[model samples]
Target chain A: MTLSIVKNATCTFCGCVCDDIELHAEGEKIVKTKGACSLGESWFKHHTAERLYPDALIDGKPATVDHAVEAAANYLYDANMPLVYGLSNITCEAQREAVFLAEIIGGVIDSHTSL
Target chain B: MIYWGGNPAECHPRHFTKYSLTQKGKFIPNGRKDRTMVLVDIRETPSAKAADLFLQIRPGKDFEVITALRAIIKDQPVNPKSVAETGLTVEQLQDLVKQMKAARFGIIFFGMGLSMTRGKHMNSAGVLMLAAEMNAFTKFVAMPMRGHGNVTGSDMVMRWSTGYPFGVNLCRGYPRFNPGEYSTVDLLVRGDNDAALILGADPGATMPQPGIDHLARIPTIVLDPKVTHTSRISRVHITTAATGVSAPGTVYRMDEIPLPLRPALKSPYPTDEEVIRRIREAVAKKPAWRPSPNGQMAIV
Candidate 1:
């Protein structure tokens, strides 16, 4: 497999968010990483492009993504007090969406900091 | 430099080499040799080996120790017997105060060990007070050693959008701040919430038994690249692309500096942002929960 090299790749394993890593990827797997600590190396190599799990699951059973999203929305809308938690390990863009979701649902939004 | 209640050697492996201690900077030409490192923890961790001095204090004594240090720094009288309860002698505190006063520049980097203990926010306030008091003698600052990727980003985003950092309640059509009441663990343990949408974190593995049980009891939804502990019990689980791995976006450093993420591979899964947007779109089709300035729900 031909290797695709990405320079200045950021590692989001921890709070450091070291952004000078040089990642060498063979297909979907990261084969080598430079300037990343051991923890970061493992984080970069952990995920792959393989579809190992179902796209979505409802009540521990495989379900379509559309079906799962609708179920999640209904539960949140039906609840008297819903919660949107855990912004850690995610992108800032997603975090923004979570805040908006919490507001529309009239719920509480918290992060790992509150723990 | 003071590392209090944090083990950067293991938790943040590149912290010492990349940001502090051993980094060769224009101000400190000799790097590690020119700087003094003082570590304060309940036990000697691997990071202690790198410290010039390691002060082991009794567990849950951070507030007491900090109070004693504040008094000592100001030359206020503190009972030696009471000071001993913190596992450090008055003489040691005095010496530490002297060093802090004489230093050209100093910084205290505290971690969860101080913030999540008995006193919780009070302990963090104590450290901040100590740092602020030290400024009378020299240039000093204190910063928290934030854990988890983009946690600081979350804080920053919440602050800019809601005027508060964490534990924000928008139930009243406006943001409200209250830690013990609105915080995750407290709400979960108290069973205050009926539903939860969890992302990026595994509270099922990290929270207390009651919190975990409350999560299982509720209609929980989770989004992650893999099936996590929380996902197992959640009512719905969606496999989102891993951030900084196959999902390109932005994340913040511990110091609140934002950086772009360059992904190296393409994943089959949708990004968390995409999935969340889809959910929001789905929810919009339903009836309005409350009247707002916009006929449709505001995105902000």
Candidate 2:
């Protein structure tokens, strides 16, 4: 087994933003987390491929990426009162894109900021 | 001076310890001992352990309790037994107020415990007013202990772009703000939205049961790296890179200070910005298009 520790990493699990985390990675996966709370440790350790849903589905059926995008766009376009929510966990760049979508569709936009 | 609602020890351990409690302020020469802290909450929290005085009040009595404390601080007589609704007598509250007046510099940090309870807005305002009133005899400031790393960032972005922080309606081609009417929870609960685009939060796990039920019936689109309760029931789930991890991007600190991120891993899926931009492009056409009967789905 190979072993390596990445230092000065930030734990994204909580608002603490504890920047002193060290991730113990074997190969490409984080196996353990140091300097993290229990919540952050679990977030990094268990967030592996087995826990992720990677397929794009439309109407509960698997669809191509392009089809998914078009379906999403169509959903927003046809919506009389569209709700664009959740931008806190993404990047500023992504948030800007979401804002662009909200403006184009003339929808109401909010995030967990108010939740 | 006071922690109105939040339990900083559990929610914001680092921030509370580093900046509010243990850290030394300019006027308060001692790092931790110089400041006399007061805690007011519905129950005992770990933060209460740090308080010089703990005022535990019944839920929804925050406004009444704070006002009574303010009255006593100003030497205004309040009915002793009536003010005792907070489980603290007027004399005990007056003692805390005396300490507040003695402090060289004081600050109150609150959280959702106050904002979500009854008299929500007024509860926050009352604490702010108390802090301001304390200024008559000493220096005091009030601040909220905001949750989530970038909740403050989300508000700042919306304020800069749309001139509103949250619950903004753009149906008129311009931004309009109405908190209760346009907010996400209200829209979901009222079944007002036809479609929802969830960017990174797990509202399904956090929203009220009614809101969650309505969301399940809607055409929901989710963009997230992890499979959350929101994405589990969403009509479409796109795996996007985590902003501060696999995708290098900028995130504002809880305090609204911007911090640049450095990616620790090569992202397998596209970044959220790229995915959102593609969706925006697809929505830009004036007339919507549909594929032919025989047409097949293609890659984005």
Q: By lDDT, who's the top model here? A: 1
What overall lDDT goes with each candidate model? Answer: 0.91, 0.77
Q: Model 1, range B144-193, lDDT digits (tens) per residue?
A: 89889899999998999899999998877789999889999999999999
Candidate 1 CAPRI category: medium
Off by over 4 Å in 2: A1-5, A48-51, B25-29, B70-82, B132-137, B287-300
Q: What DockQ do the predictions score, one after another?
A: 0.78, 0.51
Those runs of model 1 whose alpha carbons end farther than 4 Å from true positions after fitting are B291-300
Model 2 lDDT per residue over A1-99, tens place: 677677877665555566777877765467887777666677677544332455566666666768888888888887767899988888777777888
Q: For candidate 2, what is the lDDT?
A: 0.77
Identify the leading candidate in terms of TM-score: 1
Per-prediction TM-score to the true structure, in the order listed? 0.96, 0.87
Docking class of 2: medium
